[model samples]
Target: MMARTKGTANKASSQNENVVTLENPIKRGDTLIETITLIKPNAGTLRGVSLQDVATSDVNALIKVLPRMTYPSLTEHEVVNLELPDMIALAGQVIGFLSPTSVC
Candidate 1:
């Protein structure tokens, strides 16, 4: 195996801001970081998971919606499961999290 050159590491690090920084970062009051998961296009459509629905919920309710946004497809009684990728994108903004910011 080869070690990464110092120059290469610096260049890569500069390009990717998502990489954790070692220095002090700007802090905002009560700001929460959320991870937006990759959406599975193969999954079928499931409504009522949009950003509008999520934003209206109270903090506790929002907590419940958070897990479901990125959850994998599941089967119930042999029905094909659906993943909500679109909802992930929309809800990301509603919750003040950074979206993958890519259109699919």
Candidate 2:
């Protein structure tokens, strides 16, 4: 796992500010599919989650969304047992990414 931003450590910093800028811009057509394995927090045991499938071209939106997802709390049991809808619901609840986008 990556380290948390200094904004989270310092009291005076704003959490909403972008501290690290991306060197390359992720346009509307970029794609990334990562299969993240789950590990037990205390025991360091690897769970059976083989990588989840994610297909999205909205790179700009994903950058904002990915960081908010809960890391250590997600277990392999949750991923294997629950269906796609259930997983989506859980992710939305934990990450708060399901809010309606504003029309500009």
Candidate 3:
């Protein structure tokens, strides 16, 4: 698998946030089905909730809401890689994105 770095500027910081893209392992014929972005959760986002709380929350809700938030074009089957831990991490990342100041 190959990796490449992409950067985007966030209003909070003049420094570009580095986004790493990893080549998908699974494939359907010669075409790549889709690409997903992975964001590192900002620890400060978890105001009251512990990591365990985040992990134990209803993943089904995350599964439903995440596609709407990020990849609306991709179908359910396309998100097969997103398991419980992935969902929790995504939730944290999203919480950070929506309210950069604080999750509370």
- Each candidate structure's TM-score, on Cα atoms with residue i matched to residue i, is 0.23, 0.22, 0.39
In Å, residue 99's CA in model 2 sits off its true spot by: 9.3
lDDT of 3 by residue, 38-92 (tens): 3434444344445454455445444544444442233445445654444444455
For lDDT, candidate 1 versus 2, the one ahead is 1
How many residue pairs of model 1 clash at the backbone?
Answer: 0
Order the candidates by TM-score, highest first: 3, 1, 2
Model 1: residues with Cα > 4 Å off, grouped in runs: 1-35, 38-53, 71-104
lDDT score, residue 4, model 3?
26
In model 2, which runs have C-alpha deviations exceeding 4 angstroms?
1-53, 56-68, 83-85, 91-100
Deviation in Å, model 1, residue 39 alpha carbon: 4.9
Superposed by TM-score, candidate 1 places the C-alpha of residue 104 at a distance from the truth, in angstroms, of: 20
Query: Which pairs clash inside model 3?
Result: none
Tally clashing residue pairs in candidate 2.
0
**Number of the predicted model whose lDDT against the real structure is largest:** 3
